[model samples]
Target: MLLTLDLNDQRPLHEQVAGAIRRAIAEGSYAPGDRLPPARDLADALGINANTVLRALRELRDEGVLEFRRGRGVSVASLVEGRLAIVLRLRELLEEAGRYGYSREDLIEMLKELP
Candidate 1:
């Protein structure tokens, strides 16, 4: 799997790494049940610390984008497509909300008001 980091991005390194992995998943570079490179390998490829990559991997696993297998390392989740679609759409919605000067809390409130 290919992962790219944006030096210009102001987010924390772990978040950037997580976002890169997320993009790769959403772009179909990694399919359901595809095993990812080991954390050491991913760190070498991205020129980041191994711990940083592990942190990102843990976050992705928690988000259900990836799963941990005892002998298989990490693999993309089988049901990721639907989750990715919603995540991508929510990202776009947040970007649109930002353009309109809407706070994240405002979006949360809107969600709360939804039936």
Candidate 2:
């Protein structure tokens, strides 16, 4: 998986990383049980601190999008539950956008502008 970070983005680096991974999971790029790059390796590739990547991964884990095993490292969570988790997250985002007076179109447009 390729994670690109934008330094100018108002979102924090950890959020960006987690968002990219979440998008990848939603798009079926990384299927259930697919192993993700190690935090250190991903950090090096993105030219950021390993802690940032770990923070992102931990967030995903908390959200049920990814799972980290003692010896197996991180992998996409179960397909059945992962999609459900993603859908719920999307719903939360939409509600948040609504609170900010952003329409569905506005949210889609913003997503389209992301790398």
How well does model 1 score by local distance difference test? Answer: 0.90
Show model 1 residue runs off by greater than 4 Å. none
**On residues 44-86, what C-alpha lDDT tens digit does candidate 2 reach at each position?**
9999999999999998898777888999999988853646566
Clashing pairs in 2: none
How far out, in Å, is residue 12 in model 2?
0.7
lDDT of 1 at 25: 86
Candidate 1 lDDT tens digits, 4-110: 88899887899889888888888889999999999999999989899999999999889888999998899999999999779867877987998899988999999
Q: Find the candidate with the highest lDDT and give its number.
A: 1
**What shift in Å separates residue 71 of candidate 1 from its native position after superposition?**
1.4
Listed per candidate, the RMSD to the true structure in angstroms reads 1.7, 7.8
Q: List candidate 2 stretches off by more than 4 Å.
A: 80-115
Q: TM-score per candidate, in order?
A: 0.88, 0.74
Cα-based lDDT at residue 30, candidate 2: 83
